[model samples]
Target: MDLQQMRYVVAVAETASFTRAAEACHVVQSALSHQVARLEKELGARLFERTSRRVRLTTAGEAFLPAARQALEAAERARAEVAAATGEIRGRLTVGSIPTVAAVDLPSVIRTYRRRYPQVRFSLRAGSSERLVEQVRDGALDAAFLGVQPGFLPQGVRDREIGQGRHVAVMAPDHPLAARHEVDLRLMAGEVFVDFADGSAARAQSDQAFAALGLRREVAFEVSGVELMLRMVRQALGIALLPGAFGAELHGLRCVPITDGPVRVERLVWSRFPPTPAAAAFLALLDV
Candidate 1:
């Protein structure tokens, strides 16, 4: 019935435990529980089924949650808008990015933004490009940086291509093809490979290239991050195909350009809906 009670409910629903939710909301467990109980009684619905082991939302709670989140967001947006009218920005800026982002230096950008709008808080989420785009569309993230295959655009969101790069073959110093200035994909077909998980956007860059040439390479090691892939290649376990920029600063690894490698297009994506004041400020910093 009240914003405080709704905040308690949303926190509990997200954390799934009164104790943890209270910790997140900076309150004691009993007082948070009292507020939630009072709201449930006023609404004549038991929102959560609480057992010793876990807390689960009931049907009524599931129905109530979306509206509760919207109400909280709206209240925050109103306050942020008022602050913006006074030449100040105040709100949370939630952003998502793929782990291999390189088009823009994220740390530098975040530092600059913080200096400009110290009142705004920030949250960064790392995920696959597909999942990050989905989060932006669903309003779970304010914006995202995605690296996907060329000619592909994330649907249902506003996107701008920021940079483009090609995949290269990365190998140990003594690798068979390491002496070559550039290697043809066909020549490297016989080498073992370490790559991103199968079916991921990063992995697809190599997979699609080999498929186009009627060549198949063995992916002996699958990894979630570029650092791991590089480490595997460094140990001479297998070579990997990654963005050319990724291998420049790595020690003890040689990056050979692939003659016919897949092109990666980096893009910035944001929600189609009107952005919050804080999100707008961040976008303006990026000139998006």
Candidate 2:
């Protein structure tokens, strides 16, 4: 009947065990059971069918689930509204970022964001740009820092390009080309290459560059994360092509210019749901 009881029922249904649900809710099992029973009596319908082996949501419970979650979310927003009215910006903002950006750019930005607005809470999740875009679209995140992949954003999500850095070729220090400050793309012919997967933004751009030069190299490996690919390069698996930020930390690897082709640009992008005031502030910092 109340928010607390509704939360208890939702937790029980999600975990399918009262004991597990109680643990998740940080309450005793008996209290959780009592609250759900009271809620069922108020509704005059069984919310869940509990057998000794398992617990399953009944039709009534399934119908009520979404409304219950929406109610909780609305309550939280109302609380946030009151808090904001008091000049206190306090709420959780979930953000997603690709691994390369997470390692290179996020720490300083996160530190600044927290220092500027100590009352605002942040939950950062790191993943591939493709996966991060999906999270932003589904409203799992308030915003995300994604690599600027073509056709990545869906409607209602806004993406802003902030800054761009150059890409470099990463190779093991013992490699023959390591002594060179720059290597021509034609010199890389017949070499084993490590790069992003096909259809990825970086891969597509690299493909176009290679095509323009009429150069072809054997792909030794394809990976989703630039950081991982760079590490593979360091281990002497193959040479990697990635944003400069990825090679900045490697001591045993050499980053060289890939002459005879277009220079790759690593784009910084941010994707948002309906923008929040706090998120706007963060984006403003990015703009500056």
Candidate 3:
């Protein structure tokens, strides 16, 4: 019924332990449990099933969780909007991005935002473009930077294309194709490739490209991090196809232009609903 009770319930659901939840909320376990118990009594339904070992949400708790989160977010947004009216922004801004984001210097942008709005807090997460977009849609992230194959757009979110570029083949300096000015997909068909994990948006870009050409390259190394992929390429374990700008600063590796490579489009996506004041201010900072 009250915000504090909702907060306690959410914390308990997240931590799955009343003791941990109390610690997170900076309250004593007995007080937090009393508040939750009062809330459950008011609703006439048990919210959690507690045992000596662990705590788990009941069916009613699961049904109430989403609305509880939305209510909390709405209250926070209202407070932030009132603060914004007084020429101040005070709220948490959660942003997500792909590892290879290059359209804007994220650290620099965050630094500027912090200087302009010191009262605002920030959280950053990195993942594949598809996952980032999904997080944005789910309200876990206020905004996200994503990279998808050309001619495709993420659904259920508002997006803006920031930049686009072609994929380049990265290889060890001593590799035979390293000296080539540009390499065709067909020429790389026989080479072992180091690619992003399967089903990831980064990997899909190259996969769709190769499939379109009716070619298949052996992906001997599948990695989630760019540094790992680069390391594998540096050791001549395999070559990789990555965004052109992503390989520009690497050392001891050759980035060959892929003449018929997949095109990657970088986009900034946000929730379709009205954004919180902090999120709006950050988007305005980017002139979006």
Highest lDDT, which number?
3
TM-score of 3: 0.94
TM-score of each: 0.95, 0.81, 0.94
lDDT-better candidate, 2 vs 3 = 3
* Models sorted by lDDT, best on top: 3, 1, 2
> What tens-digit string does per-residue lDDT give for candidate 1 at 136-214?
9999999999988887779999999999899888899998899999998899899999988898887777788889999
Query: Worst 10-residue stretch by lDDT in candidate 1?
Result: 242-251
Residue range 98-164, candidate 3, lDDT tens digits: 9898788899999999999899989999998888888998889999999888877899999999999
RMSD of each: 1.4, 3.4, 1.6
Clashing pairs in 3: none
Off by over 4 Å in 1: none
Q: Rate the local accuracy (lDDT) of all candidates.
A: 0.90, 0.73, 0.92
* Model 3 lDDT on a 0 to 1 scale: 0.92
Question: What are the per-residue Cα lDDT tens digits for candidate 2 across 138-172?
Answer: 76677777655333334546765544455567899
Q: Which ranking of candidates, highest TM-score first? A: 1, 3, 2
Candidate 2: how large is its RMSD? 3.4
lDDT of 1 at 190: 93
Q: What is the lDDT of residue 126 in candidate 3?
A: 93
lDDT preference between candidates 1 and 2, better one: 1
lDDT of model 1, residue 23: 99
Worst 10 residues of 3 by lDDT: 242-251
